[model samples]
Target: MLLTLVLLAAVLAISYLLFVSYYPSFGGDVPEALQTKYASSENYKNGAFINQKDVPEDLGFWETLKIARKFFFTKVPNGVPAENIAVQHLDSIQIADYEGESRLVWFGHSAFLLQTKGKNILIDPMFGEVPAPHPMLGGKRFSKELPIEVEKLPKIDAVIISHDHYDHLDYESILKLKDKVGHFYMPLAVGVHLKAWGVEEGRITELDWWQQATLGDLEFICTPAQHFSGRKLNNRQSTLWSSWVIRSASESIFFSGDSGYGPHFKEIGEKYGPFEFAMMECGQYNESWPDIHMFPEETVQAGVDVRAKAVMPIHWGAFKLALHSWTDPIERAKKKAEALNIPLVAPKIGQAIEINSLLKPNSLWWENL
Candidate 1:
């Protein structure tokens, strides 16, 4: 019995090592140089990035194991789609050689493309079919088809990364997009993974919270999010997480990268109020992890807190990252938006909208599905 147990243990250890070695989602580590740079920031302390407010941290080993077990074994009816979600395709030629037209296209989840002021910006572009490093791991993307093919898309002006989580910062997508990208703007220390994946070091600019970078006439501000970051098991909070503000002379837009309900929304509103539009996080939430992801009602409230003229919901309709029903987020978010009399738009995947006019695609497309 002892000999058999020893052999099984050895095999399990070897399998884990091999899996981490080849999985693209595992990502690269934060190098010493980058860590040193991050240490100088106000957010990084005691060797990890700190949240602005005190939030729940320890879930306890037994409780965590129980939650994980429930997540895997218990099933939420229609947790995945019976049919693939619909997407709107675009022509590649028009995107590349285009006049300055302010338009935004949704690619589902947190990934979207913004074209304005003669610049094309892609934010959190996760196009892969799976969210995990390898196929067999605990990762599956709801929609296999993106609105546009990555290669067929135009060259990216900037790729904004919110954090190092697998769903938001995909590995295969980055590898495919590296050659066509012009530059990447990310939270501090996130470039370490990009450099390891073959992107040139000069192509990435890392920023701390509230630090701003300019591309053309747009000012990109990295703001705080109530979240944690790590690509692997051991490196939680090694990198920073943030929301973003994209501003031009006439228009200002906000992207809530991934955060729970917090006072930072009001703080952001006070600084950059009366935005043209705000893309707010509205999915992957649960009572078990309330501090990290906001409920659908909070989604609408966050929109109000940001002082946006119009709000579009994101972070759902792409992946089954939570136990809630597949259509629950859009359903609940739409209701809250209506009750609050908030101007809300829930665009179909890949549908393009004119940012200036702010006409919401005002329909619950997910209800039938």
Candidate 2:
């Protein structure tokens, strides 16, 4: 019993040290612009953004000990094995073959390989073993492996990041891919972390809300999302959070990075309506943090708000970040989409989805997983 207690103490000490080393706390005071904005904004009153009043008081040492004991003793269900999840591989998607049209391949979670107007773009590529700061520490990755390894990918024209969250912006994945990417676009202040991760400054492009930049024929419009951003506890909202509208002459796609149900979705739809396809957030939600993650039904509504002709749910099935059952997000999302008469598609992990013909019969591969 004494030996077990010593081992537990050592493990906890190591975990704390690692967290302190890798996880940066909130830096300094909030920016003046952000401070002014927060002061005037109604989000503060309604607990939309930062709820200083709602912040939990620091727990006493014994209180912390009790909580940790409860958590460690609790029997959380293990996630489904990666091999159990169904995946599909194509010889070649041939996105360059499709001119004046769009194609997308869902790489599970928020990662997508988008081919539009002869250019290949990757969005939030978290193709790593784990989504935590260190591979050995975090939960398991959802799929067995990417259909195509990062090295095997064709020359990528651009990489777009929604925020600085570990799941959205992986460190090892970026290190493996920094050389292959031509340009990296992300929300303002996110470039700091990317730069820390060794991406060249010239290749990184940071944009404020509603900002637009072009790469070849594709235009990436960074838009607002009702979400918070922070890598560590102290850095909450230090960087902006956003969704992106990737548009071309012939096709437009909306990638909802991660957001809850809010007026922003409708505003985004009004501005960039009638998208050919929308890859929206649809998982890892709980009532405890309703302002950050959207519920499954909210995802369907977000699809409608974006005026998406066809919608594919993401952010679920790949990672069990919330307490809900593994299949709960998709199951509830499907019901909501059907009730609203919204066109929806559920592709298997690593499945190639043709935007022009999204309704084709595909196996319900996630059922047995």
Candidate 3:
């Protein structure tokens, strides 16, 4: 009995060490002088600590604990293997060559490669193999490999991140592309995580709601979103979550990071209306967290609220983060878009869509997957 107890304790200690090593925690320390200057301000308190209301009441603590336990122990449904994800082989996509206009190529999930004014920008890049701190815990990435590996990517002028969720901000992907990236833009407290991951402070730029910054000939404006942020249990709402408005001389784009149905969308539309294209979240929704993630129909409404000329649905078809069927988000979104007469673009993995051209209807690719 004594020997068995010793063995169990040793195993538990090793597991704890591994967890700490993999998930490095931060956010306790800020520059004391800077905090003293801004801590007591109303903007610092309310704008920084933006509280999330209307969190759906379906899942209680015990219910969540039960689901989490089952998820940890049960065999994850292997929805589609990496070999099945379609890939379009293109030598290069020249945005500058396309009559000096903007274009977008989705790399899966929420990652997009946007080109405008002879510059390349990557948004919410998550090219890692898994979405969890440990590979054993999270869902697998859909593609066999990234459309372009980190080293093979062209010189990136800027990288814009929406928030620090695992699916959006991957650790390994950031580490691999850190040296190649010229600048990084993200929400206010997310710089702490980047600093923990070894990104130089000089390279990181953090912004609050309504703040705008210039990158090359383009402007990046941080907009509001109805979402919350926390990598761990105790730090909920310690950071800000937001959507982004990307505007160049000729075109404008809105990238809605994960968000629920909120009045902010209409407000943003009134401010930055008639966008050329909008990339909106359209998956991983649940009744228990309805305030954080919009349902499929709500996503369509959000596009209308933003006054986008066209919509490209994202945050689906990559990982099964929710319990619904794999294709439920797209199926529902398609019907709603058609009913509302919203121009929706559902491209295959790694496919590029021109902003001015008409969107083609592809087969239901997720059916076979």
C-alpha lDDT score of every prediction, in listed order: 0.87, 0.76, 0.77
Worst 10 residues of 2 by lDDT: 47-56
lDDT-better candidate, 1 vs 2: 1
- In model 1, the runs with Cα more than 4 Å from the true position are 1-7
Judged by lDDT against the true structure, how good is candidate 2?
Answer: 0.76
Sort all candidates by lDDT, best to worst: 1, 3, 2
TM-score of each: 0.95, 0.82, 0.86
Report the C-alpha displacement of residue 9, candidate 1, in angstroms: 3.7
Q: Candidate 2 — which pairs collide?
A: 26-234, 26-235
Per-residue lDDT over 1-369 for candidate 3, one digit per residue giving the tens place of the 0 to 100 score? 999999999999887766654665322223446445445533356324463454434465699898777645655354344355766644443432443546677888899888777778899998878877668878787677666667667777889999878888887888888888899998777777788878899998888878899988899999988887766544565666789999977788899998988998999999998898899999888775788898999999999999999887889878778766667888899889999998889888777777777465466666656
Scored by Cα lDDT, where does model 1 land?
Answer: 0.87
Q: For model 1, how many clashes?
A: 1
Give the TM-score comparing model 2 with the true structure, all chains together. 0.82
Worst 10 residues of 1 by lDDT: 356-365
Please identify model 3 stretches exceeding 4 Å from their true place.
Answer: 1-18, 21-48, 52-61, 70-83, 90-100
- Regions of candidate 2 where Cα sits further than 4 Å from its true position: 1-83, 90-100, 360-362
Tens-place lDDT digits, model 1, residues 238-267 = 888999999999999999999999999999
